[model samples]
Target: MEEERNTYLDELSGDGCRIGGYPIFVQYGPRENEELRTFDTLLLQLDCEYECDLMFGDGGIANFFINEEDLKKLDFTKVLYNWDCC
Candidate 1:
């Protein structure tokens, strides 16, 4: 028998990828600059050798940045990184 499970993917959406324990959602905009890019793509955009920083925000929801540096620093893998892309 298969038990039912409802994850963040199940809660928010079913279009993103999961890394460690965090649910990630991606949306590529129609405009050239607004489009979402891959690691290498963003690297080229910033022209940096180190890891880049990404943040997301909205109206009255507060702002937040997603950084693997913090994750690696704290050695945590279950914390949530909720970014509303709507």
Candidate 2:
């Protein structure tokens, strides 16, 4: 059951650092907030880099999101920031 659940969640997310793609959430996702759900474009994602000896509070990943409209308009003042860890 645990493995099955993990697979299910994995299908819903992509774990990594990326730009202009869907976020790889380590914990809470955008669905938790109505406003966040509107931020459809992923601006940036920074995952823990083991080789670089960098971490965001124990394997946490950081994500930045921007509304599609805002991105098109080149507005970055409203980017939403979120991070989580195991």
In every candidate, how many clashes are there? 0, 0
lDDT of 1: 0.29
Provide TM-scores for the models: 0.19, 0.76
Give the clashing residue pairs of candidate 1, or none: none
Top lDDT: which candidate number? 2
Where model 1 places Cα greater than 4 Å from the true spot, the runs are: 1-17, 20-26, 29-65, 75-86
Once model 2 is optimally superposed onto the true structure by TM-score, how far is the C-alpha of residue 23 displaced, in angstroms? 1.0
Q: Give the per-residue lDDT of model 2 (tens digit) for 7-60.
A: 877664576567877777777796579867887888999988888887999889
TM-score between candidate 2 and the true structure: 0.76
How well is each residue in 1-86 modelled by candidate 1, as lDDT tens digits?
A: 12235564355553323333322234432222332211111101111112333333421111122335544465344332223444
Where does the lowest 10-residue lDDT sum fall in candidate 1?
39-48
Q: Can you give the lDDT of residue 71 in candidate 1?
A: 44
